[model samples]
Target: MRGVARTTAFLVAAAFIPIIALAQTPAGFEFQITLSKQAAQRLASSGEGITVQASYYGEPKKGAEKHVDEMGQIYLGDERIDLPGKAATARINGSGFEQAAVKWLDGPAMVNVNIFSSRKAGPDNILSCDLIDGELQVVRKSRFAVHCALIEEGMQTELKP
Candidate 1:
C-alpha cells in the first residue's frame, strides 16, 4: 500500500511537468507608445485600417499588462475592446521580419499595443511607427520611447457601449 501511494505521487508530479513548461513560454509583447492627441483621433477613426511599425527599443516599461488574447483579441483587464480584423504585421531590424497580429488601445496621448510574438528587447532598436489610417504612409512620431515587456495573452475584444 505504501509503494502504491508513492507511485501515485510520482505520477502526479510527472503529469504537471508539461504544464509548468508551457507556462514559461512567452505569449506576446505589450507596448505603450505615446502618440499626439490628433494622432490618436486619426487612429481611432481609421476603422480597423491602422497598423504600426514599432521596433523593440530600450528597457521594458513597468506599468503595462497583457491586453491581447491568443485569439488576437484586445482587452483592458476584464473588459474587452472591439477591433475585428485588426491583425497586422510589424517589421524589426530594418529588413528582418516577424508576423504580429496587432491591436491597440489608444487615447488622446498614447497607444497601447499587443503585437503578437515580438523579438526580445535590446538597445539601438529604432522603430518606424507608420500609421496607415490615412492616404499617406507617414510615420507621425519618431524617438518615442517604447514602454513594454513580455506578457501572457488571453481575452476577447468587446465593443465599448
Candidate 2:
C-alpha cells in the first residue's frame, strides 16, 4: 500500500518537472485560461453551434494551424498551472455544463492548456469531444483568444483576441 502511494506521488511530481522547466523559459502565455462567462453564455444561448481554431508557430510542433469543432475543445497557452481537479458545474443563463477536464503539457517555450468541455448525452450519458485544438503556438502565444465564428470545414482560420 505504501509503495502504491509512493508511485502515485512520484508520477504526479514527474508530470510537473517538464512544466517547471517550461515556466523557466523566457516565453510563455501571459494570461490564464479560465471560464469565459460571456463566451460561455453566448455559446449556450446561441441557436447555432460554436467553435474555435488557433494557429501555432513554435518549436516542437511549429507552423501548424489547428481547428476545433466546438468551443469546449480549446487548446491555448495559459501560464497558470491548472490542476486536473474534478469537473465543476457552471450555471449561466439557465444553461449549465460541466468543465469535464483540463489537461496540460509542455509546449514550445510554454505550457499548453488543453480543455475538454463535457457534453451531456441523453441526460444520462456523457461524452468527451475530440481534441478541440491541437498545436504549439510560439507565434501567437502572447495574444491568443478563442475565436467565435462560422468557419467552414477544412478551412484554416486564426483566432482573434
Candidate 3:
C-alpha cells in the first residue's frame, strides 16, 4: 500500500514539471516594415535615398544597448530596394546584424524608430514622413515624397517550444 502511494505521488510531481517549465519560459518580440509602391519607386530612383534608425530603451542588464541604422541608396533604373527583414530577439541575440531585445525593468520597454529620406543624400536632408493609421506617407516640396504601409499582419513574436 505504501509503495502504491509513493508511485502515485511521483506521477503527480512529474506531470507538473513540464507545466512549470512552460510557465517559466521567457517572452520575446520582433519588428518588421513593408514599403508601398510609391515608397519602393522613390527608393529605387537615382539621387534618392532613405535611412532608418532605431533606438531601444530598457534595463541595463548587459550595459547600454546599441543603436541600429540602415541606409538605402537609390540609383537610376533600379528595380527594388533591399530592406532588412527579420525579427530580432527582444534581448541581445549575439548577432551583429540584429537589434537587441527589449528589457522590461521599471515598466514596459520602448523602441523609438525614425525613418528619414532625401532627394539627394547629405546633411539636414530630413524629408517629412508620417507612419500612422496603417499608412506611410512622405512629402517633399508639398508633394508626395513616398508611400508605404505596415504589413497587413502586424509585427508579432513567435513562441518557442
Candidate 4:
C-alpha cells in the first residue's frame, strides 16, 4: 500500500513538472478583430422576422434583413416610444417606462434597449415581451448610469446564412 501511494505521488509530481516549467515561460501573441457599432447592429438584427441594419466605424454590415414570419410580440408600454432616425431614441412619456430609453456605452460597444411598460399584476409589476431572436435589440440603458463603464459583451450576427 505504501509503495502504491509513493508511486502515485511520484507520478503526479512528475506529470506536473512539465506544466510548471511551461508556466515559467510566457507564450505571447497579439491578434485583434475590430467591429463598429453599425457592424454589430447589423449582426444582431439578422435574427429572424426583422429588418435591422447599421453603419458604423466607416464600415457597414448586412445580414438576413428579412423579417421572420413568426416572431414574438413585444408589448412596449404606452410611455415608451421609438423615435425615427438613424440614431434611434426611445422616449419615456411616464414613470412606467421612464428608464426604458437609457443608453450605455462601454468601450467600443454601445447598447440600446427599450423596456416595455409594466402592468401591475396582483402583487408584482409585469413587463411582458418576447424577444424574437433576429429582432432588433436597441440599447436603451443610460450611459451616465453607474456600473455601465466597462466594455460590454455584444452579440454579432452569425456568419452562416
Candidate 5:
C-alpha cells in the first residue's frame, strides 16, 4: 500500500510541472539607434551647446508589486559620451508605472542613448518604451531636432497565460 501511495504522489507532481513553468512570464524593452552623419557633424560643431533627454514607462503584472529601476548611457561615433558630475538622474515609483528624464549639455559630437529596466519579480507584466527625444543647439544659436528610433521591437510574448 505504501509503495502504491508513493507512485501516485510522484505522478501527481509530474503532471503539474508544465503548468508551473508556463505560469511565469518575462517582461522588458530595449531601445537602440545609430546617428546620421549630418547629425553627428552638427553635434560636433555644437560642442558644449548640445543637450540630451530620455524617458520611459511600464506597468506591473496582476498581483505583482511595483518598483522603480532604470539605466541609460550615450555613445557618439561608437565611443561613450562622458557625463558631467552634476548631471541629474530621475526615478519614479508607484502609480502602476515608472518614468525618468535627464538632461545634459556639452556632450559628444554624435550621440545615442540606450535605456532599459532591471528585471522585476512576478508574472503577466508588460513594458513599453517611447522614443527618446531632445534638441541640439550650437553656441545657443541654431537649434535642430534630435531623436532615436527602435531598430528592433524586441521579443514577443503572449498577453495572457
Candidate 6:
C-alpha cells in the first residue's frame, strides 16, 4: 500500500511539469514601422535639428483645482474665459518658425502639442508644449535654446485649473 501511494504522487507531479513549462513561456511577436517620405518631411519641417528639454511638475496656482464647466467656460472672478478648442484659439509664438499649429491626439482629455523653432531669436531653439487633462491635469512647457552657451532653464509648466 505505501509503495502504491508514493508511485501515485510521483505520476501526478510528472503529469503537470509539461503544462507548467508551456505556461511559463510566451509566444513570439512582430513589430513594423512604415513611414512615407511626405509624412517624414512634414515631421522634419515641424522642428528637427533643435534639442528640447522639458519637465512636467505640479504646483498650487490660485485656481489649480478649477476646471472648465460643462458648457466649456472657465470662470475666474468677474470674468468668464473660454476653453481652448471650444472657442479659444491657442496662439504659439517663438523665435524661429514663422508658422505653427496644434495637433490634437485621441484621448479622454484633449492633448494639443506645438513644436516651433526660431533662428534669429536670443537663443535660437525649439519649443514644445502640451496641454493635457485626465487623472493628472497640467500644462507642460519645454524650450530648446540654441544660442545660449548655458541655456538658463525656464520654469516647468504645471497643472492650472
lDDT by residue for model 5 (25-125), tens: 11111122223333233333433121223222223323323232332232211112222111112111112111121122123222223322211222221
By TM-score, how accurate is candidate 3? Answer: 0.31
lDDT of 1: 0.24
Candidate 1 residue 37 C-alpha distance from true site, Å = 1.1
TM of each candidate vs. truth = 0.21, 0.23, 0.31, 0.17, 0.20, 0.18
Better candidate number, 1 or 3, judged by TM-score? 3
Total backbone clashes of candidate 3, pairs 3 or more residues apart or in separate chains = 3
- Highest TM-score, which number? 3
Question: Residue 67 deviation, candidate 4, in Å?
Answer: 38
Q: Per-residue lDDT tens digits of candidate 1, residues 1-161?
A: 11122111100101111233223322222222333333233334443232333331111123332544453333222111222112222222112111122224222112233322122222222222312211011222221222111121111121110
Model 2 alpha-carbon drift over 4 Å, by segment: 1-22, 25-39, 42-116, 120-141, 149-161
The C-alpha stretches of model 6 lying farther than 4 A from their native spots are: 1-109, 120-151, 159-161
Ranking by lDDT: 3, 2, 1, 6, 5, 4
* Each model's lDDT: 0.24, 0.25, 0.27, 0.20, 0.22, 0.23
Give lDDT tens digits, candidate 2, residues 14-42: 11112343344433322222223332343
lDDT of 4 by residue, 1-161 (tens): 11122111100101111233323322101111122344234323432111122211111123322311133212212222332211222222223321222222111222223222222212321121112111112222211111000013332222100
Q: Which stretches of candidate 5 lie over 4 Å from their true place?
A: 1-33, 48-56, 60-161
Alpha-carbon shift of residue 25 in model 2 (angstroms): 6.1
Candidate 3 per-residue C-alpha lDDT over 1-161 given as tens digits, one digit per residue, 9 for 90 to 100: 11122111100101111233223322111223334444344345535565444333334333322322232211111012223211111121112212223331233333333445543634553233333111111110011112222223121221111
Provide the clash count, candidate 5. 0
Error of 2 at 67 (Å): 26
Clashing pairs for predicted structure model 2, backbone only: 73-132
* Better structure of 2 and 5 per TM-score: 2
For 1-161, candidate 6 gives per-residue lDDT tens digits of 11222111100101111233323322111111112233233334553332222211122223433443443332211111111111112222222211111112112122223222333233454332222222112221222111111112231332321
